[model samples]
Target: MTLSPDEIITVTLWGVPINATLLFTWIVMAVLTGASMLITRNLRPDVPPNRWRTALEVVVQGIQNQIAEIAQGPSRHLLSFVGTLFLFVAGSNLLLVIPGFRPPTSSLSTTTALALSVLVAVPLFGISRRGVGGYLQSYLRPSPVMLPFNIIAEASRGISLAIRLYGNIMSGAVIAAILLSVAPFFFPVVMDLLGLLTGMIQAYIFAILATVYISSATAPQTLSSPQKDAQ
Candidate 1:
């Protein structure tokens, strides 16, 4: 049984093979992009809403609320990137119900890319909120001797995030496959349902962890504020 979508080669560019992971990632992105365009095309401010619009609003609002809570009021600046991560991941996993479809997130390469996005984003958001100097100074906090450890910790953070997501999604797929092969019946259906729940949870966890990392990067600025105590 194929464990990673990276093994299923679909296309190649100049002898560098492209696999299902990359194909599905593009498919998911295209689907999401098309859906968003369709959903918002005729949007009106005061219309009695349709089901699609209502559901979309609920999801957007929920993401906004989560970002507000986790990032502590930086939701506006982060909604696009953070919200897209959640939506992409959740949508990828949720597509398992479709036959012959595999989630790209099951591949370490894909998960690593996602985690690296967060890795880069943490610093960028930090510098945007604080300054480049403040973000860099975080590594030497309390003493310069801690810089090496802090740097190691930052690198490990990306690895952990990638492994955590890849392991969970890949394991779930394996379990479901084993059950399906053995029984070819009811248990697989149940597993699919459970997988759906697990996928959503993983998506939320990934997004929240990202928010926490960015929040930490931005924390020094807030703490250094003289008026922070009064507010």
Candidate 2:
């Protein structure tokens, strides 16, 4: 059985080859972009909203509220990035129900890329809000001796994010595959349904953890307030 979508090569670009993970990632991006354009094309503030628009608004509002609770600064600044992260991961997983479609997130490369994005975002948001000097100073807070540990901690968070996502999604896919071989019927259906629910929960967790990281990095009192924000 194929353990990763990366095993399915799609094309070769120069000497490097593209895999199922890249193909699926592109597919997800296209779908998301098209959906966004369609959703907003006929948007009118004066007229009563349609069911699709209302549902879209509800989801956006929910993301905004979650960001506000986790992050100290204005949530509007974060809405696009955080919301996209949740939607992309959730959407990719939800599409698993389609026959022959693979979730790119089930690949380590994809999960690693996602984790790296969060890793980069934390510092960028921190630098944007706190300025380079202030953000740099955060590493030395509480005591100068803690600097190495602080740096290690920062790096470790990214590793944790990548492994948590990769392990969960890969395990679910593996378990479903094993069950399909063993029973080839009713059991696989139940596993797929459970995977759908698990995928949504993982998306929430990954997004929220990222939100907390960004919130902590952007907050004025980084050392002190992050503890509470995490809680």
Candidate 3:
């Protein structure tokens, strides 16, 4: 009846009911926020982008450029937010891959919170773009029947994002633990190599998916374009 070490690694904070996964997530978020602020505070747009600032700037600009390309307009201000989100999620997901550390993203609750946050940001951004009234009205357009379906569809994306990440990371952790516990004699070279590759890839995927979500969320819904006919 004893809990496994893995199970014991509950996503809880202070035993106050905050899960370990969520605690780890918030830590990642804080790191990203603070680091970004530190890098940005002293930045001087007066001159060309410098190294300390350039590296961060490039990351931010790259995201903004990517988003603008998709959104068809300048997104300078939003670049930092989008870039920070990607980095934070990637970092959180990679934590478990580290020895003795469990990635917060490997748990459903952790990823769910992250996904829901992103989803919520979408409507907020939509409102900022089209105003509260306009944003809500977009749901009614193309047909009211589609409204319910659209809402459901939007909800499903967040659940899917959260579940997919948790499943993959947890599966990897289980397989690795099994190998260590049952077959310690083996070199485990191939497995270790694969683990390294998978770890980095998983982190990247988590970040990439996050960026996509933000791009979709913060992106303006244009009524002029053929898509959605949102007007």
Put the candidates in lDDT order, highest first.
Answer: 1, 2, 3
lDDT of 3 by residue, 76-108 (tens): 545655565567656664554455555666666
Could you estimate the TM-score for every candidate?
Answer: 0.91, 0.92, 0.70
What residue runs in model 3 are displaced by over 4 Å at the alpha carbon?
1-19, 26-54, 96-98, 182-231
The alpha-carbon lDDT assigned to residue 132 of candidate 3 equals 87
For model 2, name the residue pairs that clash.
none
Candidate 3: residue 184 Cα off by (Å): 3.9
lDDT (tens digit, per residue) of candidate 2 on 8-122: 9988999899898998999999988998888878887787887877889999999999999888657788888889999999999988888878988898888899999999999
Model 2 alpha-carbon drift over 4 Å, by segment = 11-16, 222-231
Worst ten in a row by lDDT for model 3: 1-10
Better of 1 and 2 by lDDT: 1
lDDT of 1 by residue, 152-207 (tens): 99989999999999999988988888888988878867987898999999999999
TM-score of 2: 0.92
